[model samples]
Target chain A: MASTKTEGARRKAGRRKKEDKASTADLLLDATSELMVERNSAEVTFADIAEHSGLNPALIRYHFGSKAGLFMALLERDAGGTFHNLETLVAADMPADQKLRHHVFGVIKTYWRYPYMNRLVAALSLESDSEAARFIAERFTRTLSEAQRRILEQGEREGLFRKIDPTLFYFSVIGSCDHLFTARHSLKFAFGVEEIDDDLRIRYSDHVASILLDSVMV
Target chain B: MASTKTEGARRKAGRRKKEDKASTADLLLDATSELMVERNSAEVTFADIAEHSGLNPALIRYHFGSKAGLFMALLERDAGGTFHNLETLVAADMPADQKLRHHVFGVIKTYWRYPYMNRLVAALSLESDSEAARFIAERFTRTLSEAQRRILEQGEREGLFRKIDPTLFYFSVIGSCDHLFTARHSLKFAFGVEEIDDDLRIRYSDHVASILLDSVMV
Candidate 1:
């Protein structure tokens, strides 16, 4: 997991010497995510990645194996940070309230930067039989769900929060945060804004955090 | 919108002679929805609809203009119920508390039965420039958003509920309801449950209601 993150991060840092830092598979993956986020995943191809990242076309297959493999790698890289951080927070013997609050920030903050991750998870998840989705579940969603469940149970026991249905609680927190990112186009239509402004980004994140804190606190 | 619902219902009711009910456009739409729900929308095609519904392939184009048209019809049909119901409740000159409570039920209950509807909305909503997505924005999303904003404003002014960012509030409501259905695979993998039972369904709806009520009630 760390390897993927470092690899992706290093590839990103190679912005100065794009050609000098050769064979960084992460650029191809970045190209894939960039295209998918701007457009749709189904329409993305290796050629598109080459065009965007200035990588040789052969490097796409040489690095990531296949199309699904490319995205699976990206999902893994990001999940390592979000889910792994959540795991750490949950495991920490900190105040349950603080842990839960910080957890909300971590989840929402990740989506704020990488809105398309939600779409990827939803897509892979719909295919239950797929190895990639199963891997994500084993590595990410279920792991985070368990951690959240533990925090909720502890918080309730400590009288810091109400007894929550953990599954719904997780979804409520996530859904609220993700809605702005996932529903950007729809929100644009509703608010008549061409794009979300920087002020709204701060407002949206704060709005989401307070909503969760107020809803869950006893 | 009401016309589409009545038309679909009347067609469904003519079920006695299933085969004799030839060229029922609703069946074609149902077949398409059924396939899309089971799998992904991109993979579903006209032949699959014909295979699933036992209808003539030619009848597909005859009834709906194209594949996207067929899904758009289904989306419109479902939106009619959810959006129209919200409009009616928002317009009703009743106590804001009662109206808002009923509104939550309308939102969650519709999603309870039609989980794929969430996926369809997300997919179409992301494609802002598409005619289908734009039509959805005008017909369903914008209209419902205005109604939700009105209810929130009225409730807060009356001191019946706390002030909330109406867009975030609406997203929170939909996200909580939509998560269990959309993330069924990851949920299944987490808890090792093969399918969501009736109990979880009831618990989920109640859980969602209480979350909203608790968060908003002053």
Candidate 2:
């Protein structure tokens, strides 16, 4: 009976340790995400992250094994959330037009919520030779292609979308929306606007959706 | 006769020195443009640029006065070229449709020729709070807005384009094309492509033109 009680206590202790590690990892990533928004990723250091997270610098090394490892972890965390959201949207039972609109708007909304994501991605995209960068490139492509394939298939079945290359269509839609925000400085200056408010975002989103629907559909 | 020859010699010496300085400045800017393509501006340093340009490190300081000054010179040089091309296209007495198509193709070809320009602009877009960044941002925006205003005026006069917000339309069209290359890695992954080739670029240019024409035309 005493042995049984000790085993139960040990199991609870193990669960607590797991929870602690998870929380610490979350804290580290949260700090990294915040910092990345303010500055370029190349400008960030492990010590900066530790100071921001209020965790020991050594803990980062212990948990992630290195600075690059920590960056990859942050990317994985954000990408996983983004992918999950994408999967849920794609899995819904809706008309292809509605699905496409939702998917595009949803992505724009997600990206806006995390403005640093595009910069982080832009940085990695250029550094394609790195392992972490390659992972991001590959994973994002696979995820997007799968979602695009499904959307295109649905549109084709409904005879709504034209029979052009789905990949090209997808790229156009994404490029239109993503560039507006990533190039915010240039866009704002060119248009004499200060910020991308809610109304403008809605209009921009509608414009992108129209471009995609009008070009792809009959 | 002696006074005339002495004056002529002095004039020649001054011209030689001025030409030397101009050539050295050109060399630094040229090297900077190349370095900026492979790495972000923040990663570039005087030493790297000197090594690439085969000029003394002090030459950059001597010619441009500072790193930021050198960057500005590069920006002015490239922006001047791009703006010149755009102006030439706009000044032509072509119809709205043809003018728009030529302008779109011109921008795409320019981007492809100086791929690093996009990277530099993207970086500037993010770091626009800085003086140097803002200079580039302002020039780019002013150039784009002027082109857009000309296009809109032409479209209105020709009764070809629908009455739409010129700024929003400009942003959408430019965003669509620019983002594709800027986010080339993500697009490549999503489409399972190797690299953006000539055929893909041509298709993209054509498709963007079609979408813009369809959306804006009566």
Q: How does each model score on lDDT?
A: 0.73, 0.73
Highest-scoring model, lDDT = 2
The per-prediction CA RMSD against the true structure, in angstroms, equals 8.0, 2.9
What is candidate 1's fraction of native contacts?
0.56
Q: Which stretch of 10 consecutive residues in model 1 chain A shows the poorest summed lDDT?
A: A15-24
Residue lDDT tens for model 2, B31-63: 887887555334578999999999999998888
Kept native contacts, as fractions per model, are: 0.56, 0.55
Worst 10 residues of 2 chain A by lDDT: A120-129
User: Candidate 1, residues A39-151: lDDT per residue as tens digits?
Assistant: 73334667888999898888878776766677677888776657757767888989888887787767777776677777777666654347777776787677777888899
Query: How far out, in Å, is residue A131 in model 1?
Result: 2.7
TM-score of each: 0.82, 0.89
- The A-chain TM-scores of all the candidates are 0.79, 0.84
Model 1 CA deviation exceeding 4 Å by range? A1-23, A40-43, A54-58, A91-94, A126-130, B1-23, B40-43, B56-58, B92-94, B126-130
Q: Interface RMSD (Å), each candidate?
A: 2.2, 3.1
